[model samples]
Target: METPLTANIKPGRRPPDIKAYRKAGGYRALREAVLKMRPEEVTQTVKDANLKGRGGAGFDAGLKWSFVPMGEEASGPKYVAINADEMEPGTFKDRLLMEGDPHQLIEGAALAAYAIQADVAYIFLRREYHLSARLLRRAIAEAYDSGCLGQGILGSEYSLDMHLHISAGRYMSGEETGMLNAIEGRRANPRAKPPYPQVSGLWGNPTVVNNVETVCNLPHIVNNGADWFRNLSLTAEGGTKIYGASGRVRRPGTWELPMGTPLRELVEEHAGGMQQGYRLRGIIPGGASTEFLTPAHLDVKMDFVSVEAAGSRLGTGTIIVLDDHSCPVGMTLNLEQFFLRESCGWCTPCWGGLQYAVELLTGIEAGAGRMEDLDTLDSLAAMLAPGHTFCALAPGAAEPLGSALRYFREDFERHIRQQRCPWSS
Candidate 1:
């Protein structure tokens, strides 16, 4: 109910063009924002709406924008970057938004750029998203032609330029500083913080980097007042979320549900529950990076605070279901291998520790693991925790592994004791 994000996205239909989009009240928010509202007013509206970033980190969007040095005293040529690189495993929500309603993203990005007084904007998209890239390019052209972008947008004094940059294809490239590096033709290694992208980014300018879904909420937040936007959610987070599900479920897909919708509703109602003959084991209530939750936690609200209170993040709001037929050790090993390969080698904890974790999990799955290996895996998880890494990649990698060990310790023992994976035929 009240799915503002996906109301226009009809299955099997091509995305609406500029004319069609306007006819359906698309850029009205941009028009109102540019012609009537001041840049600070736009930022204040979003802040009042309590819109949180949907790109894994649930940071407040307006609070983040408020960090930018504003007014005539602030520096010039500030930037806004849209993190369209939807590389998170089991997360395809951004791809759907970009391909389904490209103009919505453009309008949202323009609104965000306007709010921050940004002179330029960029969509740092993953290279694998060719279709999304094409759709966005066309949408950008349409916006420019319609005078929604470029010099003196809508004849206002504020001018903005936007570009689409295809990423160099690293999961780290989705990280704020890493995406900034990759956008500048450098290796996608994360930059050390303190002067975060807000104050200094993209050629050392004040750049605001936000996720696709996060920015897409801007147009709606502006079109409807902050109260309307906040009321759309079932919880305090404000607005709806594009919750997705994959693996073993009968209907594995994404849905635009009220924020804080229960995990049980997503799996049992929207995802059509597990396929026949498959009993629920656990669910990674976010992307691959989050911890696992057993069937008992199904009633937990799918919000940032609730999910985190349940001991996992509401990462990407995409649940990856694990069935009874699957092996937890094998699943963890597969996930660890992905994290190991995707690591940028920027830090030893991430690069070296993930490789060790993978090796241990591999041995356990291959029937060569010892009971002591579980202790070593636990050590690796602690070593890879948040403060030890240059970025979040290693910590994210540790979540599923650490939680698997916690929730499914018996399964790891079963593999070791039996000398083989029980689920493997």
Candidate 2:
């Protein structure tokens, strides 16, 4: 495959033929797993791979699937929701799986459906991703026509039906529960947990929801074997991720790279270094939601565990560089505005706390904030979490804010004490 853990083909192109997929030994594992191997074997392969979710949570993919009740419990009409809502600020890696190697995603989705014994499946796509939606729909249709998605696949009595649903362009819909609600034609608010999607979802049946990137990795694991998949990354982290870097970079674009690729190598080599005019100051290592990483942290490995060790996540593997000219406070405020506006308003803390945060941040950005507001913002973030009304939205909202205060305290102080933002203003 490619440098990244994932095999990315050119955009909007399918493999030349099913024969091509066959030549690559694609769908062979599906046939083997269905006709010869059992669903338990399939799940065990993924578990052995130690595959982590490419979504923000980084939940172990095998563990999440294991949540599905098996044996007689895995009876008919179960569902697996493919999360294609790639709305995280710096996250667009899933778009590659959708656009480039659609068949890989289809095969992967089929594997998960088989493993979970899902009778039907849905690919919940972001509304703004009209192109991806169209491409996936076409791929789904192709799978059905090719007998890959329909009943008794390769002579096994496993019948599966799949469909695609588009989401309205709202950030909240990316949350797993929210995606389920939206799929059911609800108003897209998060459902209360304890009854997580694995228990009651999509018409009150047990469901398995996985990110697009996570599912796309399945076919490779099945086709190439789990150890090969595990060894894809030189480090223990294994597998490939589509890495994207923007802002102040000479060549700002996405490349499918190995998981343990050093952040410095990505910026300095793959990304062609920072642009000539803007010297690199610090970076919002993932998307804007992640904490900023100073140049001192460049040598850190850019994998989930390593990035987390460096005080940020390998979230969606999107690296947003901040140049010396960019004001950290202004950039952080901009991100806060996004979170504040996108709150689902299902919970009191997020609804009110985020609004209060905006006020405090705006005051600081506009030179009206007092030093005390910094303390207040931190306290507000603490109160807004685990205390929130909805899903991960509010807690995810606090991540960057809390991290910014911790890492870039001086920048926040500059905004407040100097009575002005150090950036353009």
Candidate 3:
């Protein structure tokens, strides 16, 4: 019931300005963090809070920050890059947070930058988010004018500068390494690991790239301490989650609920259940990249570990429902096409394997697929498994395809056997 993230957000109205935000207790955490807590202390508090990244990866936010080299003798000119590229399909939670409360993001970014001892921060946002860009620019100016950012923030020696960089727009650009490349004016192809971004990133300095929502939690985590943040969740993972539902659900929107809220509650209660006359067929329990879940798995908790245990991810905590009227094979084909087009072409498994999967899916949906193509599709999924790819794009693409085959084999068989889509009118 405590929606801390969205409590200050006023729907259908402009976001709070600096004065309004200040009166409402915004940036207090940033003040406390800069004036009192050491940089390492900030990071340790977040780690103790068990705040995991809201991004699909679900890695611990503080754990990721801990990897950055600290101390005066450590790397200089370190950076904190906020990944605001909300490119994942069926995932609009980040956009809502950014559009609804821009300063929260700015304050959070400053806190994150302070935590990592980084003087420079960049917000790598998608070009399509024109409104978010405009509002963030305004907020940044306000923060600077108010002494929250740049040259002795809040009268402390800890000065930080923030930059907003609009991306040209690519799904690959959302990946951390790929985001770094795009930010550097290089092609958005993913960089190889081992020289991981924590040690060497953005002009080859220690840079920490965190998702927008993940950074947004920093203010709350610092304001209330780790225990309060952890207690906000329904499960082991700390804090509330912005859960959303799309497709035939009567009320398709996002809500900030306790972490690990059940999937059934999200779809049936919050989403208003399936639209009249329709029944739930399946669900992609995150964004387009996550594995599909059948109706039987509705009781699964909507958290990282629980969802993973249920054989999907709490990806962006957004659910895309598949109604009885929709065709599973066709849906799979549609998803594959998006993945195929978005492939950065940096790795053959992603570019090459995704194209082949798309073609096979297209053929099957078009009534030309041979039964043997099923075997080939299975092989394609295996080929694009996690270790075979340069990044998560291909592997994430494989999730829905592989899971669709498992849960909707009958649908695929029907399409092939009927030599046409059964649901086609």
Show the colliding residue pairs in model 3.
Answer: none
- For every model shown, what is its TM-score relative to the native structure? 0.99, 0.94, 0.99
Output the lDDT of residue 358, model 3: 94
Error of 3 at 6 (Å): 0.4
Alpha-carbon deviation at 422 in model 2, angstroms:
2.5
> lDDT value for candidate 1?
0.93
lDDT of each model, Cα atoms only?
Answer: 0.93, 0.81, 0.93
For model 3, where is the 10-residue window of minimal lDDT?
Answer: 1-10
| True-vs-predicted CA distance for residue 74, candidate 3, Å | 0.7
On lDDT, the stronger of 1 and 2 is 1
The candidate with the higher TM-score, 1 or 2, is 1
- Candidate ranking (TM-score, best to worst): 3, 1, 2
lDDT of 2 by residue, 1-425 (tens): 45533444654465334556557666777787778778888889998888888886788888888887788755447998999888899777888767776677778888998888888888888888887777777777777777888888767899888888888878888888888888888877898877777778888888999988888888778877878877888577658877889898999888877778999998999899988888987777777567778899999998888999998777878898888788777777888889888888888888898899988998898889999999999998787666646687777778778877887899899887789887854
lDDT of 1 by residue, 99-124 (tens): 99999999999999999999999998
What lDDT tens digits, residue by residue, belong to model 3 across residues 173-242?
9998999889889888999897989999999999999988898888999999999989999899999998
Clashes of each: 0, 5, 0
Cα deviation at 258, candidate 3, in Å, is 0.4
**Which residue pairs in candidate 2 collide?**
4-240, 4-257, 5-239, 5-240, 5-241
